[model samples]
Target chain A: MRRREALLHIGSWMVTGAAALSAGRARAARAAPLDQPSVRATIDNLFPDLPIDTSDAVAIEGPEITDDGAHVPVRLRLGTQRDTPHRIALVASANPHPLVATLDLGERFSGPLALRIKLARSQSVILLAATGQRLYAATTFLKIVASGCNPGQDETPPTDLGTIRFRHDPPREGMADARLLIRHPMRVEQRDASDIVSRPANHITMINVDIDGNPLLGMACGQSVAADPYLAFRLRTPQAGETLEIGWRDTQGRGGDARFPLGI
Target chain B: MSLDRRDALKAGAALALSSLLPACATPLRTPPTGRVVVVGAGWGGATTARYLRRWAPSVEVTVVEPARAFVSCPQSNLVLSGGRNLASLTLDYGRWAADNGIRLVRDTVRDIDPERRRVQLAGGGQLEYDRLVLSPGVDFDYAAVPGLEGEAAQARVPHAWKAGPQTAALRARLEAMPDGGVFVMTIPAAPYRCPPGPYERASLVATYLARHKPRAKLIVLDANPDIISKKGLFRAAWRELYPTLIEYRPSNAVLQVDTDRLTVRSEFEDLRADVLNVIPPQRAGDIARRAGALGEGERWARVNFIDYRAERVDGIHVIGDATLSTPAPKSGHVANQQGKVLAAALADHFAGRDPYRDPVLSNTCYSFVSNDEAFNVAAVYRVAEGGKGLRLADGSSGVSQARSSEEAALARAWATNIWSDMLG
Candidate 1:
């Protein structure tokens, strides 16, 4: 019954312009009030009242139809060469929690921000980006069909959680390419070997990267990040011998950090 | 994801009207008259040359290919099981260019002078063009495996990745092997031409062994972590049909090869077999290297995906299996689609107009699992907003739900249609 109300709220929110903004503002602007508190908090911080118009500036790249709904590879480029987006947010309307992730992608980092996310089902995946004052958006519909194998099929989770691996190239053209793979199941509800249902809902909540004590990138992941979440991004002006630190915390209150000594 | 007949006519009319307008200051070619020289007569090059003639008859199109007949690599695997012969797959370009008013040169291109926009032919000649298309396909990186570097070694254990002599030799070797002998085939990592090709070859070979040898075993060594394409269908087909005859080992990249011993060694173990098929890692053919298309240490040519133009060189576009098109597997279908798109882009360029901003490309590849059953994987791509690369079009890509004899018939039809599309 509550799902119906949430659907109606989302429908009204879909209507753009001053009417929808004001209507959404009156309703507390909760994109996914039914989701977890952390996810809801992140959604609230996204300024849902802001108007979003479709623009070609943003690029949301992924498979049109995916067999594995458990993990869908998505690459997001917030803005084009003419426009530099200061922040970007992803929302999948069909997910229990529409808000997937939000990243503070500063103006300097223009390369594609690639990561994997879990889709509940076929839905429209929306990318919202803010360049200067105006907010722009792009939407790509993704269809998730049942795998010919089992549904929710995923690679075996790494035995050790929070194990992070980094692969990066030396600075090129004032930017450095880096890839990160964090070991976490990003588990959804599943039946255990004991025939008992388990819903841990443990997933990476926050991702922080620092280079020599300076913040390089920050991201907040919701329940939708995929298993052993993989991320690839470009860092601006990374130098040799500099220490790069990556830290993440999951919903279970467990946290882990790793440090890499950059080399040429 | 195709332009209809009306759309093609509209584009042609636009070209005609635009050609009447005053020439833009930065036209791609001066005076709007252009010559296009396409190297190789494979799927991509032939399609490009043919479509270029149709789209813009004023632009001279010349195709320089070494082979007399275009042997298709798509359906060549059936040769192993005697389902299809090499002769049946070999398509003749009989006066295709002459009838279309294009030039067809039977020669090899040794080097590409991008600055001068000329290609040096091995038969002691040079062809100058306003634009050059290099669709030379893939060349095996035999040096990556030490023992398989020399010609004699390759002849001893044929890769048969290409569709000509090596394919025939490998088929003969399979027929000659004694009963109960093991046939070992190695699959290179992803980004190779035709992702499902090695598996299809393995399946047909298994079928041959099942019927003729009966006691023989086939081992597939895959470099990838798992089945990369048509995974479910291939696995199910293997389990249902070739249960006892085939063994698949994933993540088994070839570390070394002992051609004389009929052995291949991966990081995990070494296997000796009656037949060793070492499908080595591949890169853009040598002509692309001569054109400075591939970057240092890169295996494939980097192109400006919009028009398939080489990143480092101007007036030279590299297509086909030789290019690195991420998310778009290297295949003849993709090359043919790229050929049409590049042809249209060239037409727009010569007409002093901007190339179509949103270009769509679709690829459909069929893999025959046995003599009578097959499956397919299809994808549709559109130019990304910024035009860096192609993104899968919304809700337009997937694999066949199941394998069937119907799809096998469709596979043959696809081949017949595409062959005519490229060479007709």
Candidate 2:
């Protein structure tokens, strides 16, 4: 009878420990709330009057250890069980340029996303995903060893300048993943070979994504981006047999575009 | 791995034993007779000449070739990247020809008249032959890609597929590229000479750039979806040794070339190049095709494994890169083995006996991942019936498990042995 009583006591202590662990995790997730003044301000500037869940309903997936900072693969998944996910935004909290990307998905888009983003330093990347009724934010820590964004100066004018290439990965549901690499020196500064004076950014400044005449996302970046300007992202899957075109224009108005078929 | 000297001797013995007579044949044990004329004088032709001299001394042998001496394509990649010299690859045939009593004609065979049993030469000459052996190597299929048709264009955008002046020219171009420049080399579809040649060139060039021109990048654009040969070893070298210096893009077959702009346009992208080496698609050498040995509309000549005779043709045998020998790659080693096997068969044929009922062939391809490190893929083949050429013999083929300095030394020794077997 005494042994039975001891067994009951052990079971109760185990349940209590699990409860405390859950509460501790919940507090950590909520400690850096989206409602923080700076985060709230940025949020209000882009999207206003949105209540945040401050729960573990969003997860950031990526490598825990990275050797190259220029090309790190990152992805975000909605943790909520229900279906309707409208949009999501990612912030590289440590990057010189913090606004990584803002993805706008409709009812047609699905599947986990895969993308290559720049991380200036070792830090946590935060994500805020929006569903029908609530907002979710999650953070994942990453360690960077080799810096990528700025390998060298005057890396422009590659041996064969002005070459453009595109590749598309296998897509699932209504979401497609793609990559585009342009052989431009991405002359960010007023380097001599580029022949541009101060503040004349030859680096690609704007990238526009479209599918079958429908506009999707437009990105604006600065000189901190890497050379060769490799860009990869996920977007709404184009209509079957439709054409998906990714076009980019530099600050100097030198622009080009590449297109791929959606169906095959 | 290659067959050691002892294994080669064993194979020679088996080939000799195979000279026994077949059913429905007369029994006559004597040296071979009549005349045998071989064209091209490459690994295939040289081996055939040597073995014919040894196995059938009664037969008169003649080799008709345009080149002054034999220049090997096996180690030419090293020459391109400064790992070796062209002189090391150049070999003379004076000793071998004199010792074998084989007449060497420095003239190109233009056409073959099977009915008349004569060959027209480019130098306005003709040679009669009781049997003809053709080992003409591959010719580039230039129409597959655009902007490299004329001689001037070829000079500007060199293929360098054949080992000669073009190989040296490509090496010079690579040496002249800027310190931080990008060099792009595109690979043609498979079935080209030396399946690992392009990757070997890429690796050795990577080595050169890493030492002399730091920050330079090499981009290997492959028409196929992945590395065609010695894939694991090549990938390890790319990942560990040259993670930053090399960029491999496969399934990006070049569709057009802009020589003036120095651009390689593939199915999905346009790549700019400081130096462009365009290895184009390949087909059987032209003389074999024109002689109707490859049929009316065929890319490769079909052959019977019994004698390598072109289908539906008499007194003509096609070997080496010209024949569609499936499962076995178009390699010099395989061609050499074919030459030896055919030598024994011809000895029996002329001696009023039968050819070998079953034959086996082997090829070993060594690829240098760096100047001092290499890997190899060795395959053995069995001649199956119904004219399928040689089938890859199970359990006798595989790639090297790793790349190391040992394989590099073995590769050097292998090249020396094979060259001696053919030219010495």
Candidate 3:
């Protein structure tokens, strides 16, 4: 009779232990919300000294719902008047480091600039646009269902020097869209799903295009640039057969140059 | 004091009994015990075998490949341009074998015995296994291209499709051509390895010719009017960078080759070439036919999407370039994902647990227009319900816009990360 009583007592103890263990796990999971301030803190740390102000001049265009997060088309445009902002910088707050790209419009006019950015998880992406004096900011919440952070898909380290690809869109009269693609891993240091730390940060720091020795565009960049950075900006005076010289510099100070002649 | 002492003893006893109850209830399912024989060690085969060893530790994995080492086809274009060496691209199976406990059988598989679950090696040895994975890469359909027969073409006109010594041979031939000699390369129709590969090769070879042999030229005889993948990008690079040295002739197909006369006859005209690279149409590896693993058309192996097991045969799974997976290109990235899926299914089967339902697969292909320029197309796929086949998920997969610098950079990063994920 005593042994039977002891068995019943032990059974009750086991049930209590299991319940406590599950409760602890639930509490731990609830403690770290996905929308924690850590993401915002990361953005603040990426650009500490830049003179940034919030404005409605910058517009971030992306799919309302992305089917695949691996490659999402993200376009950032800065609105300006003769007396408005001269530069625009785009930041993806949900990304590991949050800063995707920063573009400076140096006395250029008309049209919008677009590029792709990678998101770490689905969250509100903060776009901070800075004028010559003040900075304007906007936030858009993007629902990312999938992540490209799985390193299993990405095995090779991109070469230090970026790949340069030039594509000629069927030229129409005097203007043609020149697409220059550079190969860089652009890995933002972040822990992946497998708990593996990503490689050190590598991104194209600057890109310059010269049409027959005349500077068309030059700009600085950050890690928010997606892998194999594609820079597609139009050239105003692209002739049927003029040489377009392109050069790029990476964060490591390595540089590469390629020249392609314009063809109609 | 007496009640507290009794309660402490009861708690200790309960903790020990609960730990014992799980062992008795679950009965550590003996991991499925069997040898998994994998034929071929290319991207698909290698990744499948690697993942099998990782996910299903109880299964013995053996890889049978003829080559001593593997050179990645994804990066071979850089080698032709002299950007990277063959060694940099080469990988030994030792690390994969020792670290992962995979058995590397360095021999050619002469025949596969599906009924006996055994494989006969070239040297009269046989390996018995419960499951077989055949990812034999790609085989050239020589009959597709007339007059390009054996012996002479293999000796003089190199295909350089296999990516090792043949790659070196083609590079040498290009380097040795006379200052004004023409280097003719024929691009196959669709469904070839690496759609952007031929164009990238042309771009790099042109880059070499521009610097080394100024008078030399590259003539591309393409089967299609426009090159696949990044044709627009390549055309821009070609016209802008090496306009004088490169000429593209689209909608031209090679009908015959005259080795003795050193000439190629197209449907339109007969052209003489100092060197020739006839990239013939490709199909699934030859072993799939002998093993009775091929589908109806003999082009690719038919496999069930949920588990990647052969649809026609039992106890066999085929992945990579050899398998006919809808919406997934015959890319290394896709193959690796398929490998993981197969591994997961096998692991569950061994544990006597129901495998996760409707496995999802993903892939991304990055193509370089030049050393510095790259683009990519990415997609995600899942098995259709009722076990019919695989389909691209409604909201997954896309190609980057025609020419965005940011998209191009992302494509390059995707390629690098893919390489690291696979081999690193």
Q: Candidate 1 residues B4-115, lDDT tens each?
A: 4225434434543443333311223333388899998898998888777777767878899888888999989999988999999997777666655668899998878888
State the interface C-alpha RMSD of candidate 3: 11.6
Each prediction's DockQ against the real complex:
0.03, 0.09, 0.01
TM-score of each: 0.63, 0.62, 0.56
True-vs-predicted CA distance for residue A183, candidate 1, Å: 16
lDDT of 2 by residue, B121-140 (tens): 99999998888899898988
lDDT per model vs. reference: 0.75, 0.71, 0.64
Q: Per-residue CA lDDT of candidate 1, range A14-107, in tens?
A: 2221122222332332443224232233335554555555667777888645545666778887665557676677776556545676666544
Tally clashes: model 3: 47
As a whole number from 0 to 100, the lDDT of residue B407 in candidate 2 is 86
Runs of candidate 1 exceeding 4 Å displacement:
A1-151, A154-264, B1-32
Least well predicted 10-residue stretch by lDDT in candidate 2 chain B: B19-28
User: Worst lDDT window (10 residues) for model 3 chain A?
Assistant: A14-23
Of the two candidates 2 and 3, the one with more favorable TM-score, higher being better, is 2
lDDT (10s digit) by residue, model 3, range A172-251:
55444445567676655545578465554556667666667765555555555666666554445556677877788775
| Candidate 1 chain A: worst-modelled 10 consecutive residues by lDDT | A14-23
Q: For candidate 3, lDDT tens digit of each residue in B248-312?
A: 86545676787666688663346888878888888888888778877555677777777777878
Query: What lDDT is reached at residue B297 by model 3?
Result: 57
